[model samples]
Target: MNFHELLLCEGNTLEKEKGEHVFMQGDSDKSLYFIQTGLLKAYYTSSSGKEAIKSFILPNDFIGSLSSIYAGQNCSFSLVSLETSMLVKIPFEKIVEYGKKDIVLANNIIEFLMRLTLKKERREHEFLCMSAEERYLALIESTPILLKKITQNDLARYLGMTPVGLSRIKKRVQSKMSKQGENNP
Candidate 1:
């Protein structure tokens, strides 16, 4: 089942401008959000204020401080819009209230949460095992649309590479693609 459908039916819709923070680090809000349009980035800020991009959330994806919500603590990461966006914001309390009355909704929420966890785990493994070029190529293969939507700096950060490094990878990939096209032609 599409989790966004449930969110759209039950949650409050909110519009966010580009560069706006949906929820900042250390925020106490436990509201979950489903992106309906545009892009968002989840990031971590170090004590020295260096930002590290964790993930770029696209439309139909969910974003929130999951660990914080589970732990009853403040959010550890901030979610900011990379473009003007629309989102369905669902309060955690409301989810519990609704879940008590609906078993299917409860199961769907559990399944969605599990899928998120598994995706994160897969990404972690990829980072540990994949070269920077391989990681970038995999991203291109999986989410090419993101290349158009996100800034090079943000994409570099998401792939755990410097902007210059990412540039080199892009050049290499493009050159390879061009060579393949010429050969086929």
Candidate 2:
């Protein structure tokens, strides 16, 4: 079967409304999901009930399979729709079994996982090394379009900060830049 057809046959198509949750933090280890359209934000809720955005998946982005494929583990995060989303949910067992037989699917899964791993590693490095201003600029530069679509709260969470904290950081950066501009101009 073709990739899309295989996905359709093996998975259930789901439509999630905006602000509606697709899966909770500790849902099930049953199935995986592929994003055919729209956006999803994966997050972890802290002890203080603060939701931190781990990542955002856009069109053609894949999800749910990462923990299953890479760690043989249940989801470490919750997934929620940022907007109305169309997703294909595939059984985890079916994916593991299919990977044994289909070279195309196996390669696709490998490539997708590699990309995900690299992204996560990059974020880890940034978290440990980059300054707050540098991190904010890097995020803005990476997803320039997202600046408008995503909320400040979500962006703050992605940066591992509270909304108020992010606001202060933004103000500090702006003030510093403004002073620099005055000095130069």
Candidate that would win on TM-score:
2
Each model's number of backbone clashes?
0, 0
Error of model 2, residue 171, in angstroms: 1.5
* Cα error of candidate 1 at position 25, Å: 0.9
lDDT of 1 by residue, 79-157 (tens): 9998999999988777877778788888988898799889999899888999999999898888898898878998898
lDDT per residue for candidate 2 within 1-185, as digits (tens), equals: 34566787878998999988877776655677788888889998887887888889888877773564457676678899998999998877887788889898888778877898998899999999998778998887888988888999899998888899889989998989789889573
Clashing pairs in 2: none
RMSD, one per candidate, in order: 2.9, 2.2
Off by over 4 Å in 1: 1-10, 172-185
Which 10-residue window in model 2 sums to the lowest lDDT? Answer: 65-74
Provide the overall lDDT of each model, using Cα atoms, as 2-decimal numbers: 0.86, 0.82
